[model samples]
Target: MNTLRIQTRDGRRTDISADTLATLTATLRGRLLTEDAPGYDAARRIWNGMIDRKPALIARCLGASDVVAAVNFAREHELLFSIRGAGHNIAGTAVADGGLMIDLIEMQGIRVDPEARRVWVQPGTTWADVDRETQLHGLVVPGGIVSTTGVSGFTLGGGFGWLTRKWGYTVDLLRSVELVTPDGQFLNVTAESHPDLFWALCGGGGNFGVVTGYEFDAKPLGPTVMAGIVFYSFERAVDLLRHFREITGNAPNELACLFAVRTAPAAPFIPEEQHGKLIVGIAMNYAGPLDDAMRYVDQIRNFDAEPIVDLIRPQQFMEHQKFLDAGQPYGRNYYWKSDFFDRIDDELIDVAVDHWAQITSPLSSSLIMHLGGAGQARPLDSTAVGFRNTEFVFNMQSAWDGDAGSEEHIGWARAMFDAVHPYSGGSSYINFQTEDEGDERVRQSYPAEIYERLVEVKDRYDPTNMFCFNKNIQPSAAVLRRQRADTSPVSD
Candidate 1:
């Protein structure tokens, strides 16, 4: 190891001697990587190819002990650090430029207690990992639609997926979390234990601490589910979407559906002639009995114009989780803008359709997910997740091959976001927010009271703002004042 220049918590640069770096390396059970390290390049890369940050050091944590060592080292040195799970966040907040990168990707572990209907997952575990284990017993944890999404970041940022309507947001199923605080204390947090901290962890983002493990109350779902996509011609999108809004409004809790507009991909299920043509798709998952699911499928099939492709069928739950994974592969250039909507009205549909026509990239898409069932039944203040009354979420995803057309694709997504924002309920999904959507946009993710409460928790647990990499919530003035007033040294 050599001397390294790293960023500090106060936005200043400082150098650490080789001996100091060696001390940190020796304390870790996992390997530590510097810029010159053989695998450093691949270690720092995240899901979004648009992000190209170079961290000064990377700690590949293997377990809770390694996390504690890394946290203590960073705290003692007053170093700025970011945490990486599966690196699936669109904002690319998992990697910090010229700072310590706590790489948790190697800590994937999951234990399922099927009889108790619960599971404990490591921070690095992806939804696919959890699904693989839980599905053996016909159980599942509410997780993201993409199989590769990290369990920790997704649940902390308010997870939504095909099972959301039936099981509620992922946070709603959380039983407890084992966390390493900024000051180096490891504690198991739960609603019955540290109620305030536990509440903040639910949709509060990663402002408070580094989560080592998550315990969730799993639901009995299936080894097989009736789930797939039904694609329609773009010409009939307006009529089809209006009908989509009607049926979804009355959709049962067991039926979860999402509407999307994008170019058709070349797949066996899609006709070769329709390849590259723009279309609207209604993707659905019915978690109940097979016979009951077909009735809702009939409603979608009854639209005036015939569907260009209807591939709805019985599929393994794990297979359904990977349905959209191909389109959002790692290293793709992705930018997104999103908001919550109370209704999918005519005016909102018109704005969405107009923006859909100007999509700059074939891989880009506009999506509206119907989102009011079991999730909405929870009280608004029950957890850090607000906007429970939200009927749908609108996400404009801009994706392209490389940097040449970055501006054009991002512009299309922004234009559509600005146009459809009028129909929004003045809140947003934190996970879908892009890197450039500044602090004010993050504030928009929660209600006024909820944001204030999150700040309080952040102040209490992370007074110095050590974890400012994610959708950050700064500490209160009083907390900083107390820290400055006390001249006592920080304990390791």
Candidate 2:
């Protein structure tokens, strides 16, 4: 493979020798793919259609040592590097342009300790893998709504999911992480060890290091849960959405709901006439008893008309998790923006409905997730996750078939965000960010003090910023000055 020699984006020729490539390949038990490999195209593909970058090489890491060797090789050769977990990042940062990619897809290992109620999962594993493993003991950890999302990116960005209200963000359950630093030193990060790194990983995204695995605190949950959708037409959206806001505000922690506005899919439960019509749908998942949970949700039936579908009933956790899977598949052009709101007022509802009526694609949709109970109760500084106390967090997304319709869908998403920006909390969720947003939005994702701390940590761990593909935190000059002034030494 001639060490995958290539020209950089700035037109500089860089080279790695054939012997170095052989040494790198032998470091891992898995395969190292180059341009000549048959799986190169499949390995480079990500979840979004908008991302099209071809890496010089893709190293499928089998274990921790493989990750360390890859990092060291990239640093030594001055090659740009990227890390791939489940390859589901909407921003498409998982793959780089003409760089070396360390693909963790071969490291799908999960160990569940039922007595301790904890689970250790490797980066390549998906949420569906974790849910299935933990459910055997009637236990589960909080994860994203989409089962395909990677645990590494999801938890790093303070994961919010179907059980957020009851269990808190996915970062809240994170007990420890195994990471390889930019300098290729491996460290186990947790509250008791490398506490600063632990804080930075919670919501800082994958800016600091390549996390190989995560140890999470799992909770005792159900083999069965009460969940399903309650669909309503767009005509009653304003009233029904406002009513939903009021109810979730006072609802118990075990109850969680999401308000989605999209064209109704052709499901057996929905009438065929409404297949392409815009509708306001409530996706509910309650972890408590079925009869009591239904009591609080029965008020939804009192709307002006009968719902197009009411599938709320007792079902297994896996069944409810799989319900939303069919709508979201791989290789679609996706654009998403997220923010938090203190309330869903009539003004905000009006803005949402207007955008809903003009939706340009079937896959386009918006989500308003309630943030109360367990989610709101966390201390602001308990972890690096910012905007924890907001009343609700909402995400706006636009998905379409191909590039022909991209501009129209992207324009609508931006307009919808602008209309509701005034009502939104200043910060945004890190996982939903787009590449065009630049550095400012990344800074806002964390609190000011926490962001400063993250920069200091960046100076200590990744001083050269080898992992600059993510939402970066550049070390400040002041931090360097403080480090010089203080003669205290720390160990890795």
Candidate 3:
């Protein structure tokens, strides 16, 4: 029966009586965690090892009703709160210091409609979870490359993966979402039902509300497909990169490839001497029929020079989705800088190669993900997703074992990002942004019209700016002024 001191939306601290706290806890079917609670520390630990935050209260939500309770409590108290799904975001915005943390990790639910080729997924469900059920009927939802990524954050922030070239970004597959607004109203939002809200959520990054469930249009792809990676010597990085760009430029919708420059891992497929040495790799997924996929695979296999390791072959689609999982294990310190590219010119390629040679950590890498195909075919105004006409995405990902050498690793990523930014399309992916990138970086993530439109949506649904943690989009000043005026006392 201890009284609690929680942070308010305006950054002031306020005390809540034990009775009040107990009332909220009692209404929840899930548990409410205080600082001294048994699982508080474990619940706060997220995928990134660098973030160490402590929320005043953690509401472990078990279902939509639990989410409703938490949202209502926070709104009534005017408490600052953050939402956590799988806690996999690199920015670590899920847990707010001294504020309420709506932990949705326990709400893992997935219902698939085989006949409709659709899925209704709970916020806590990960790409791996969704894939498991969808693949039961040989259907799939386009999701993030990392299997551990949460469906909620990934979908809200414009998700893409191996199937992106064929199916489009994850948001494109979204049919509807079940949301709990800042004011505690539950809404099942769809394009036809709530056009503005739906557009804002497509790539808006959790700025509007807490989404409990996502309904996605799933497409049939694979029980098995031709996919894997090919490793080459770093000495031929320029030529290999050019080859990768050339082939990908002419690639069909079913073929997607990512070019990476990093040190090789000590896997059995690679030569012992080549392990831990710098190398360039082309990881590919060809989702069409096996017969047609082999033709594209053969072209890479027969490139001018022999590959150091060739692991490309037919594999289960789920296995292909998890190809990068080992490299992105949870609790590892990670820093990322990303942007979209209109084209991979020689200058950008050289800059990336130069930065690759100066890599501070063995776990760090520079990635060039080929874009276009189905994604580009969609109009720029079709959804809130930014930079549709771009040809590729470049990400400078820095991963290290611990907190040691953090400066060196981060500095390297920033330096690389700066060198290659001039070649960028001037917009970046919201999902890849880091915590320190600031509000301007967020504004740059969308087009001028799209950013302004997102703000209008925010003004309408979240005028108080209750959810300001993720790449925040603030409510308009006019709306705020009107709200203040309406709440002011009447004259005598």
Assess each prediction's global lDDT (C-alpha) against the native.
Answer: 0.90, 0.83, 0.90
lDDT of 3 by residue, 5-43 (tens): 999988899898999999998999999999999999999
Question: How many residue pairs in model 1 have overlapping backbones?
Answer: 0
Error of 3 at 41 (Å): 0.7
lDDT rank order: 3, 1, 2
Candidate 1 residue lDDT tens string, 337-440: 88888888899888889889999999998788888899988999899997677989888999998779899999999999889988888887788888988788
Clashing pairs in 1: none
The all-Cα superposition gives candidate 1 an RMSD in Å to the true structure of 2.5
User: Candidate 1: lDDT of 176?
Assistant: 96
Model 2 CA deviation exceeding 4 Å by range: 6-13, 477-492
TM-score per candidate: 0.97, 0.95, 0.98
Error of 2 at 454 (Å): 1.3
